[model samples]
Target: MRRYGPAVLLLLTGAAVLRISLFGDLYLRYVQAGLRPYLIVSGCALVLLAVVSAIISRRPYDDGCQGHRHGPGVAWLLTLPALALLFFPPPALGSYSAEREAAARAAQGVGTFPALPKAKVLDLTLAEFGSRAIYDSGRSLKGRTVRLTGFVTRDDDGTWYVTRLLISCCAADASTSKVEIRGVEAPPTDTWVAVTGTWHPEGRLGTDEAWPAVLDAGDVRTVPEPANPYEKR
Candidate 1:
């Protein structure tokens, strides 16, 4: 049994990876969409290696080494993650994660933002709204009714923000962007919602401060978390 430990560890780890990538939302929590192919390939390769190792372990060996060989004890640690992935896969990042990191802001002198879309009500992402509100000198958001969606967060001062995580690669590298919501009661923390409002233009611009751009919310309603929770940069 000890001689086959490495093979067992590989098999379990590979299956866990494949199970998460193929059958669940686990991949989205840790990686970007473009990485799915590589994950799948890696899972398959690990499983294949496990099979080869198992076969080799079962074969006859010379010098009385067949049953005496033992895998390094450290290899058993790999099973812990495999078991966790199978039984307790983690949820997507939420208000706790948002609270841990400082809010992201548009960089100074990011250059001119393009014109806002011509529409009665424009739908904008949290990151895009932050960029325009902070860095766009054109004030494209003035007098525009726009829609934004994100989870709710409340500050110690009783202020509320509609917050979303922006991920360039994965959750490990995720940063948050938010709009300070006014004129509506804040929903429970981490509750997803869509807010329709106009930009208030009172917040500072062109800095990386944690201050959220202000929005005067006309309407607020709870909604299901989207299939893809993190907004990609």
Candidate 2:
């Protein structure tokens, strides 16, 4: 048991990474899709290491560990996180996280953005809506109907906003963007919803330095959380 202990630990760690990255949405909570290939390769490498260690352990006299008789007792600590990840994957960033981070906005006087895509109802992420509303000199959103999906958040003054987090690399670097919703009661906090609305230029324009842009919603409906929760840059 002692000789094979390190192998068992590596096996558990590798399995946990692969399980979250391939078999479930847990990996989406930590990293973007581009990192999936590296994760899979790392997991495969760890599993291969476990197999090699186990094979060497069975040999009576092996030079792999310089014939050390002691097991990797402290190394068992590495398996704790793997066990936790397997049993209790963390939830995606939502209202609570949105509340904690400063609202992300496009820099005032930034470069021009292309005209809004033509559609009866254009679908947009909250970050895109914010950038166009706050930085686009052309006021591209002046007369367009757009749809946004995000978890619900409420302001201190009782206004509700549809919010999503933007992640450049991982959850640690995430920042939030939101659009205030008018004409509908705020949904329960953290409830994912698709809001179809037209932009209302009542708030600070040409910048979100003062407040988030407002959306005069025509329809609001609850929806399941998307498979990929964070907006990637």
**What C-alpha lDDT values do all the predictions have?**
0.84, 0.84
Model 2 agreement with the true structure over 1-233: per-residue lDDT tens digits = 67787798889888888988878767888899889888889988988999999998898855676546665578667778878877787788888888987655455665578877689999998988977877676788888999999999998899999998889988898888888999988889999999999998755555556358889999999999988999986
lDDT of 1 by residue, 1-233 (tens): 77778788888888888887877667887888888888899889989999999999888667778436654677677788888876787888998888887555446674578888799989899989988888778888989999999999888998989998889988899988888999999999999999999998764567665257889999999999887788997
Model 1 lowest lDDT segment of ten: 102-111
Candidate 1 lDDT score at position 12: 85
- Residue 89 lDDT, candidate 2, scale 0-100: 74
Candidate 2, 155: how far from true, in Å? 2.5
Candidate 2, residue 178: Cα displacement in angstroms equals 1.3
Clashing pairs in 2: none
